[model samples]
Target chain A: MDAVLSIRDLAVEFKTDTGLTRALVDVGFDVPRGEVTAIVGESGSGKSVTANCIMRLIQPPGRIVAGTIEFAPERALSSEGQAPRAPRLRAPPFDIVSLPNRDPRLQELHGGLISMVFQEPMTALSPVYTVGNQVAEAILCHRDVSRRQAWRESAEMLERVGLDDIERRMRMYPFEFSGGMRQRVVIAMALVCHPEVLICDEPTTALDVTIQAEILTLIKDLQRDLGNSVIFITHDLGVVAQIADQVVVMYQGRVLEIGTVRQVLKDPVHPYTRGLLAAIPGLAPKGQPLATIGSVVGDADIETPHPLRRLADGRQVSMPQDSRG
Target chain B: MRSYLVSRVLGMVPTLAVISVIIFTVIQLPEGDIVSSTLDRLQAQGVDVTEEYVQNLRAQYNLDKPLVLQYFYWAGNFLTGDMGYSYLFSRPVNELVWERLGYTLSITVSALFFTWIVALPIGIYSAVRQYSIGDYVMTSIALVGLATPPFLLALIFMHIGFEWFGVSTGGLFSPEFEDAAWSWARFADLLAHLWLPMIIVGMGSAAFTMRILRANLLDELNKPYVVTARAKGVPPAKLVLKYPVRIAINPFISNIGLMLPGLVSGEALVSLVMGLPTIGPLLLQSLLNQDMFLAGSLLMWLAILTVVGILLSDLLLAWVDPRIRFE
Candidate 1:
């Protein structure tokens, strides 16, 4: 019920030499407080675009055409019914989309109130700097702590992220770490300031199955411990089932279905959503041919407006107009 | 790090040895040694060619020895700092080389500094601004600098100095200070004339380095790490400098090895045109007159400098980038 980020009618467009192409259109979702909201989609499904829009990090030629990404940090930060911690920015909910790129308020919110864990842990970190230096830099960016204090805090954060020998590991470069270890360091960097909302953009997609499972567990455990909202963008249904409290299925830059994990996974209404569930490899009978979804949604289907119909179970599914009629 | 340094220094020995063999063979490949060229000059000057005198000259200079033995004698003496005699200059090769080396080093070193100082900021600006008017203008100027040869630029500066400043800038010193003792005034005169050749020799390299840096920085600017830094709310200036620029500067550091030899040889034409007393022209003269020891020693020194420069650059590269260091 309590939403930390309420994005409404978000639209983003990329200007290519060919013409303007829609990256996202009429996309809206709420990331509730102190819960994992997994956004599932195939590649090019605007999952990353939504994440970038939330952070206001869309580069040139890709601009948010319309949206209100309302971030109420006060609600997210104080939801535990205790006094808010230090480094808290006490402000009313503000539209992140409307804020200028260099607005001091928006910058303060970045890496402090709303931080991101990028997809590629290998390249997401600077190679030249030591892990300790980078993590401390994140702390120093948001909080007015002494350099020594920041290093100490960074060491503790690294320890918290399941890294062994924090002292020695901190001095090592990112390239020195394994993929899973680098992802852990990245998580430490993201959560160093104890941000209210952590946007993880496919954090485990690059790791092996075992490491992926470990990282997912680590994230879930940390989320439970830290009590911060997490927007987990992933295409793996298994991962969404394992970690997500709520689910948002996106296709062609549009949110087709949004509901609680059980509601959407067990009782999905949209044909596209049903096709996605059927395409899961595990659900197919062993030794039989894996059932594949035919092309059920087309360009015309996306272009046509399909109003979201709320089912009795509180799941919202957008059905094609012809099927609904 | 210490082992790396030691191994690198030790590695240069075999490289220099192979190079020395090549240099000796190549220099010998040209017909006749320094003695014949000296005798030809003498004969051209109407000096009578006597058999006894010729035999004495051959025995004294070891001209009659086998080529392998000749190579050993020269190489053996070279290792002991006995750079053999210069038949053309009629002086010890060491004296002639050492004299010019000081001036050569001063010009090359200062020009290197000049190139870095002029190129780095402009390169950073061009990359950061990318397509802005300032970037376009800087790029145009850099292209022009790249296109113009150093000798022509030297000639242009000479004419400008003579016509506009009412001062001749053909050498490293004014006429009065040409052979004078070192003094504040002589140094001042040297400084005034120095800029012309420095700019002439440095322009092409500075333009090249700037374009390299700009392109490297442009590539780094789009990397995921740069975007990560930006997403971390790093301010634009600090983000650019601390992240992308640091990585972009690796190529420049790696280029130090190539740059040293390039600047030394590149200064040759400019030095010839300007008539500055540097090794370029000296090397040129020794090579032309078949002065074996002098030419061979100069080439050897150039090889040594190249090896040392590469070693220094590798060390600096490792120091600047931890990835290279750990590897």
Candidate 2:
């Protein structure tokens, strides 16, 4: 249970015309080293917000009200199993929440130690620049490499992402590539610097179903090769089952369940988790109408605290007394 | 790219031909050719208006020809650089147009550079700092510049030149250099007089382009690609200039075509108000007096400028944006 990144009691508030409204409240999770942690919930359930919080990319009008995201990667050996460099000392674990937005360390951490892949691949890359120029730009930003060297590395990374004809593809723009191919370029850009943590915010949500599976496989393969921690945000439970090692089920900005994939999927303690698992189309009985959860998760109840209780099987569940069986 | 350019240039021939026909027809659509206007002036002085004199005037000017034949004669002459005679200016149309073209282009080209140079950075600032006090102030000034007519601004500039700067009002030269040859001193005088018109003419267009760029940059700032660049640890300034500003400038580049014709003819009112020696005033006076060859040639020149400007802009747009280039 070597956690690479730990977020504790993270809360986010967004300013609206009415007043301030909470987007995330008392959410906590751990991304274990070299493993995938899936944040699964419906839209507006703060799944992406939690991922954004970890990346420190919460835009204006939404501020982190309370939180501490502690990132502590191992210092002895790099994630790629290479010998640690003796010249540049490794930085100690620090709270990302406390670093100012303009701090050099925070800027260095972005795309250097932690990187992100956004949802829409169609618009993730600039239209005016070539794929090689963009990927090389990322490398140039983080590393002390010459433009020619960066371009060469970019070509190799593009080939590594399963793109054919790396030389021709490097000269092409994002619009020239298909959606799936564009997603591969985006993944190459995110992984070019070999960051210790990669935050994928619905990386396959906008792709075709088959392309989605391919992208998922590409990400999983890249993660395994890089041996880095991944915070995978997705709404599809099937994707969770296929790729995630740990699952954190969130409902309306509140974490209702958190455990290993086997523990949470086979034995979901929270009623919302059970409801979600029951709603899966493939898991339903043949020719029968999909089962619907009768009880509604009240928005008002989120304000009052409901402490998470640990179960015998080592899964954590927030069981509000009124909804408990 | 070479083939595209050749095809685009070839495409302009038919377009210009069609536009030339429209310009000739529209000029003729107004009642009374140049002969009638001359006759009316002579008649006002109590000269006998004979039918033979009218026929002779018509015959001399080729006014008796059919409309289609007249178009062929004018079009043929125009293509060969023989722009016919201007009855109003009492000189060849080409001489009148060419002499004024140097002055007209100097004013318009400098004004265009002034507009872009002043507008671009301010536009980027206003958009990036959206509701900040500086943005609000710039936006307010831009609105004022947009609302105020160029002619009125020219007058105000003249007044300020007279009252505060003690500089002579109107024209691109002082009274001493009005008819003098292009000596260094006369050129210096021209440069001094040039700023007033450039600032006055460019202010309105600069305001318009700035607001457009601001709106465009605002839209581009929120796009996913911008966020992607920011996530790549690109500093805020470089991120903005490299990603969003580059895309936002496409509209600004596309505007070059429309701005060419506008800078030429749109200077008419301001030229008249300022009494500058540009083609705008000549074009206006020619159209008013129904001087057929003069007005026709001038209108034809405007049409040519517009078509050529559009071609230039399309080519530049392709160079700036890869999406349009391949398409």
Candidate 3:
């Protein structure tokens, strides 16, 4: 499959009062074009950091030490050197790392070609602004439309995100909405620009299971209609099973395995991957203790609070240092 | 909205009444009655002052009554536009305050305006470009402003004005415009000497507000929504103003209450040093002399202003923060 975003030797570190903690080290992956690529990891395993780095949203004290995120354009631009507003046209491939923050190419890609839907939609929106204003802001950021037109288009997008009372929802603040509604508004804000790639950072983690399923369905539906690629990050294996076409399992900031959903789930290659599969609740036999990976194989000198839980099963699975399988 | 306003405004009545009683009682706390003090002053001035005269004045002014009844009499006269009298000024307290009100207002307003205008951008910049050289300089200057006494600053500026410029910057206007009508020259003259007191009065508030705004904005900048906005390709400037700043300015809105009361009452020491003809000095003098009606009335008016300030701030908060659905 043709890849839209190919990351190479992606390294990230966080500077703290104590010392530098490796957040992402030698991590790499290729997101197939027009497919949902889910990056799965436990908290503090750098799943969110990878997404933030792609958006260049990593603040000071946390830096992308080394990496190249190359986004491949699906099609060519017209002779005018101008991007077509229609989703039919493809954006040129972007070097997300090397480009200056103020670069027009980056601005064009961000919110226009690349957008992110964050976890905790409650805090992901400014409470002072009406949902319409925020959506309009996203549209007006890239598109050369009048404020009224942006509002009109944004309201349409809000309706597209499955919000029933579009007019009322648009006028209300984020604080006024239910968790589901706010998440939908966030999705609307991200998708309003018709971004080619939507990076969802645990978008459904903060919600209930039912809401999570609905959001997952909405994302799938939007992807089907819009034909944009998605990079969904979450620790929930169940969600990955339902939505993802390809899965990337991460352990302590390193990619353990990458393959199709059936390949990874039916026959997981990495020991950590198999452990994750075993850790899934309600799947194990009713009588026996659930299987779990106890400890890592190698990495003794690299000392810190390890992200993966040490299980009572006592079995350990570590990355084979020589192989890149 | 109407209910919010009505509740806030009506709530002031009880507050003001409580303040009025407190101010009157406190003013009366100084040793000896106002009548005996009057006679003592007369005796010191070489008049044949007598006990009978003191007793007559005390009975006449109803100073012989209980403290609560005295407060009622004073409040009644006050409500009727007679702010009793300023014994020190040999004039009615209303006349004294009204005569000086405009001068005090100009100085206070100018100081407040300068404080906000200067502090806001500097605070924002320091927060945005935190750890940069300009931010460091601004922070250091803010510290200086916070630490240095305003009166000392007033004195320094006054001395420099007289010594270096050979022009005294003590009063709000030159001798020519002391009693001049509203002319461009008098206005310009007032503006000329306005800087010293404005700086003295404004410096601490500017520094304090800067620190608050910087901390507030820094906090908002770290929020996930700000990241969402930035990811939305919201330009740096608009992203800040549209999202983070709007959210950050919540507690800052309440500061309007703090600013409003200070704008009218004036900073007492700074006013004394600059000799800017503001009410701070007059009110202080009245309080010191135990001029009960004058001091009580001034304090009561300030309390009323404070309550109005709080109400106005509450209204502004409701307007800015949509989450505040006032019942």
Candidate 4:
């Protein structure tokens, strides 16, 4: 399978008042064409940071110390005899990290070929603009569509996100909607441009369980229909099990384990990955006194004095690195 | 909305009451009698002090009553729109105040427009090119304006204009203005005299506005939506102008409340220096002579202007920020 997106030895650091603090180190992953890849880790495990690096959203202090983030545009063209469908990434095509801050190529790909759905829907949108205006703005930014055409496209995209009464809702502000509706609006905004890759950084984490399920289902359905690669970052193991086809387990900003979801979940490797599995409750033997993994992967303090339970499994869960995944 | 308006209107009652109390108390605080002072001053000028003149003046003005009764009488007259005659000017207080109010408002309104039009673009540019030479230069100039007193700046500019451009430190309009019709040339000449004083007053206030706008713009620049706009491939210029000027300027509408009251009240100092026949200069002269009717009425106009200015700013803020819904 061709790599739809490739990141190699990605590292990020922050120049703080104290000194250089390494935020992410030697992190690399690939999203194969038309597949969902989950970057699983606890918060502050550099999952979202890596995703932000792809979008160039990382700002002052936190800098991409070293890496190569390449997204091949030519991959949209197939070499096979079959009709030239949208070519997916075959290999590393262009280095995103090394690109000039204001490169036209990066600008062309930002909302055109790539889009992102942030964690908090409330903050991700401009409170002053109507949903329809924001979505239409996204469309008109890349496409040569008239404002009227853009509005029509925005309504259609809202409808595609399962929002009923798209016409009326588009005229409403984000505050006028519920949390789920706002998330759908954000999803619609991201998908409006038909991006090649949708980098969702904890998109469903802020939602309730039922809404999370609904959003995950919507994302999966959209990915299948649009034939776009998905890079879903999450700390929830159950969510990873449900939506991720491939999983890259990260610890301390480093890739701890990378495999098909079945291989990683069913037959886990890597000590950190095994610990993550052991910490989750429902996955253990019924009524057998749940096994707890000992040792924190990131900044978690597992051994700190807490009510100790000597479980039969003899495994203790430590504090995870950063809680911001 | 009606309830809100009613509440506002009702709230003004207490405010006006407090103002009346303060005005009455302040006017009555002198040790010597008003008649005695007036008589002494006239006698010093070699005019005969007459008991009949003083008693008649007191009875006609109804000033012989107790202070509270005098206050009530004036308040009642004010409520009935009978502002009474000015003892000093020998004209109706309302007519005198209203006429001077136009001149005060003309200078203030023109200066306000000048401040906004000049400061907004400068503020935005300073913020956008922050840490660059342009930012440094603008900041330095703003600091000078902030530190220097307006009167001093007025003096310096007047001296320079007088020497270099042969500009005279005349009143607001040319001496020939009364003879000439209200033509554009006459208006232009009026503006030319008004410009220096306006700058002296406006620049003193506008430095703070520039600093505020720059800070506000920088804060808005850090917002996530601004980043999102950039990622949408919006050009740098459009991104800076759109978000900073359009969305971030909501806070600035509130600043109008402060500027309006200051411009209206502060007109006295600058007008005195410039010899402009504005309300500030007139009010000051009246206050010195204990010209109660003219001074009190003019101060009331200032109070009304301040309230209206605040209300206008709130309305403008609601219009600018879509998130603020009246309903």
Candidate 5:
């Protein structure tokens, strides 16, 4: 299978007054085309940071130290014989770490190829502008559309995201909309460009359970229609079980396991993965007390006498990834 | 909405009445009485001044009545738009003050326009480039502007202009102002004379305004929405202008209400230093010689400006931002 996006040996570091704090280390994973890939990890496990790195959103003092992120060149038109095409050929799978931020190809990747939906819907929108105007603004910025066409497209997108009274609500400010509506508006904005990849950073964490279900379902349906890869970042195993086809378990900043949902669920490989599965109360055997993972998250020390080393069985037995990374 | 407007206008009535009463009562005070000043001046000139002559002079000026009665008489004429005569200027109070009001407003308003134009971008840029050397230098200049008073700044500007730019310190227009047609050259001359006063007042207030805007923009930049926009793959320039500036500038627009009073007060001081015929020098002269009508007329104008300024700000808030509903 062709991997749409592949990340290898991805390490991220942040400079602080104390010292360099490694946020992500040796992170490796691949997202195939038209699939929902879930990065399952608790907060501070660099789940959000990994997504941000993909979108080039890491602020100052935090940066990708070493990594290779290769994305397939998005084909604008199928080559029929030797017909002439646009002068700018699509960017081939290149190391995102080495790409200059201001490069023209990099510029095209942003907002054009990848769009992000943040967790909090209320804070994600421009408060001064009407919800409709803001979505239309994003469309106008990315697409070659007239103002009238942009507005119409924005309204249709809002409706597609399951918003009721899209026209009336479009004129309303974010404060006027409910939490679910705001999230829908955000989704509409991100999907309006019909990007090749959509990175949802804890998209449903702040939402209530019912709204969470709706948002997740809407995202799944949108993905099916748009045929774009979705990277879902969340810590809840339940959410991963419901929506994720392939799961990448991250402990601290390292990927612990990468496999199909059933493989990881039925036969967990890593000890940490086993512990996480055992810790789930409902997943335990009937009438028996729920087993709890003994080790605390983020408790691993990086400077201990010995790091986790491979065992003789060739099983690579070691402590879980260090949270201090 | 109509009721709200009516209530706001009605509230101003009591305030205006109180202000008028205070002005009228203070002018009718026994110390430095109109009759006494006239009699003293006549005696000093070696003319035989009598109580009857002084009393007749008081009657002509309507200073013979009780303070309350005289206040009503003046208030009655005032509501009818009769500002009475200015004993000092020898012209009608409204005529003299209104004529100068145009000149004062022209310079003060132009300076205010410049202040916003210069401050908004500078302040936003400084905040966006926070901790950079450019930000540091801009902030330092703003602090200096804040530290110097408008009049003092005006004095310095006047000195500099006279010494270096060969700019005139007196008159908005040149000596041939009456003869000159309304041409670009004439307008340019008027603006040249305005430079010293404009810089003095504009820089003083614009510094504070810039600081306020910078603080506001910085606060907005820290907001999660701005981060969201950046993470959404919006270009840096678009992200800064669309989300940060649009959000941060709301508070600054709201603050226009407070800035109005400062504008009126600053106009006086800036006009005084520039030797422009604005309410500042006019009010100053009235206060020195105790010309009550001139002072009262100017004070009322200031009060009116305060009300109008706040109303304009509210309307602008509505126009620029749809989130704010008047109801």
Candidate 6:
């Protein structure tokens, strides 16, 4: 599979007054080109941090101590196409870690080459800006267009995102729209620039159960239509099974399993993966409480001391390919 | 928009009416008034203090009437622009007030203008570089600004001005310009003398405003939308102005109602120290001497500013914050 992005031996730490706490250690994953790569981990497993790190959006007190996020050459990224244009991509991958926070290169990539959709739609949108203004602003940031043109394009994007009555809705604010509609607006903004990679940081976690399905379908449909790679960060195993082409199970900032969704779900290897799969109630026997990770690994085992540091010191422990695959 | 303006203007009537009653009644609620004080002053000067003369004076001044009747009499004449006579100045209250009002507005409004112009950029910079050395220095200066009293600052500036510039540092205009006719030279002299007082009055308020803006902007800068905006490749300056500035300014804009009242009485104590012929000290003197018309009219003006300021702030908030789909 063509890797659009590669994260190698990623280690990040948060320095508080008390001491340093490792948030992500020896975390590595490849987001395959034109596919949804799901990183499933509970809160504090650094799934969200991984996405933020890719965008170089990590703020103070938390720093990426060791890692290199290599983004594929921009030449391969088409400005416009149904499928990503198959041009000969000759330029070397850009090292995202080395770029300064406000470097023009990084700014160009952000919202232009690589965009992100956040989890909470309520706070994600600025209250002072209209739906159309925000989307148009994103376009105006990267594409040099007059305000009128940007707005027209934004309206088209809104219509594309399943928001009808475009002209009126464009002028409306976030509070005017329902949660589902707001999320769609955010989606339109992220896709407006036709970014090559869209980071979905638990995009539907704050959504209603019914609306969540619609958003997920919308994202999948858009990814297909736009031909952009997606890094879907979530803790829902069911969501992973449904949406992800490749799955990476992370626990305590360490990658436990990485393979196709079917391989990991049907024939799991890692003990943590087995426990997580078994914890699903549907897979359990009838007339009994669901088996949980705490039951399988025990409470003490889940917090296994330095499970991340056990392998090659400061080197990636990329798992082998399955013979079945 | 028209309805909003109509409602706001319509809303001011009852408010001003209530304030008028309170203004008249509160002055009387106090034990002694202009007559008693005048009587006291007369007796202190060893003049013949007589019940008969006191009765005559009270009757002449309409003080013998009921409080409600007194209020109606004052309100009736006031509504017709005859703002009673200021016995203290021996002139009509309307003439006394409007004359002093120009001097007061020049200082207070300029102070306000200076405050906003200086405070906004400093506040923005402090928030953007929070915890940096520049932020620390700016924060320290803002704290000093807040802690130092405006009157104390005025006194210090006066001493410095006299010692350094050999110029008398009190009042709105230089000696030659005080009663000079409106001329280029007089205007120039006023400009030379006006800045010191403006700085003294404005420094305290500007620093206060800066700190508020800084704290509020810091809170907003860390918000999700700010990060989202940054992610959209928005330049750093535009990102800050677009998202955090607009949100942070809600509190600042809301403060306009309070600040507008300050335009009248912002540095009453400071203006007193500077000996500037502003209305603030005049308001105090009128209250002390029980110059009912002058004090009441001034108080009414303040109330009007407050009501109007609040209405303006609400309208401005609706304009700035798109979230308010004001029906």
Choose the strongest candidate by DockQ: 3
* lDDT for each residue of candidate 6 in B1-327, tens digit (9 for 90 to 100): 788778878988998999999988877777876688889889999999889999998887788998788889888988998888887888888888886777777787788888899899999999999989999999999999889888899888889879998977888777767888999998888788778878888898899999999999989998999888888889888999989998897987767777866645656888899898878999999888888778988887777767877888888887887666556
Write down the C-alpha DockQ for each prediction: 0.65, 0.72, 0.74, 0.43, 0.48, 0.73
**Native interface contacts kept by each candidate, as a fraction:** 0.60, 0.71, 0.90, 0.47, 0.48, 0.84
lDDT measured at residue A186 in model 6 versus the true structure, 0 to 100: 90
Query: Residue by residue across A10-86, what tens digits does model 5's lDDT show?
Result: 88999999999889988877888889898887678889889888887787789898988887745442221222223
> Model 3 lDDT vs. the true structure?
0.81
Looking at candidate 4, what is the lDDT of residue B240?
79
Model 6 lDDT tens row, A85-161: 34564445778998876566787788888999998898999987788999999998887679999999999889999
Look at candidate 3 and tell me the lDDT of residue A168.
Answer: 84
Q: Per-model TM-score of chain A alone?
A: 0.91, 0.90, 0.87, 0.84, 0.84, 0.88
For TM-score, candidate 1 versus 4, the one ahead is: 1
Find the candidate with the highest lDDT and give its number: 1
True-vs-predicted CA distance for residue A42, candidate 4, Å: 2.8
What range of 10 consecutive residues in model 2 chain A has the weakest lDDT sum? Answer: A77-86
Residue pairs in candidate 5 whose N, alpha carbon or C atoms collide under 3 angstroms: A22-A325
The sequence of per-residue lDDT tens digits that candidate 4 reaches over residues A136-195 is 888887766799999999998899999998888999987898888888988888889888
By TM-score, highest first, what's the ranking?
2, 1, 3, 6, 5, 4
The C-alpha stretches of model 1 lying farther than 4 A from their native spots are A75-90, A283-288, A295-303, A309-313, A320-325, B325-327
lDDT of model 3, residue B156? 88
For model 2 the local lDDT of residue B84 reads 94
- Model 3 regions more than 4 Å off: A75-80, A83-91, A283-287, A295-325, B49-56, B64-66, B259-266
* Model with the higher TM-score, candidate 3 or 5: 3
Q: Which of the two candidates, 1 or 3, achieves a greater TM-score against the reference? A: 1
- How well does each candidate superpose onto the true structure, as a TM-score? 0.93, 0.93, 0.92, 0.86, 0.89, 0.92
Docking class of 3: medium
**What is the total number of backbone clashes in candidate 1?**
0
Clashing pairs in 1: none
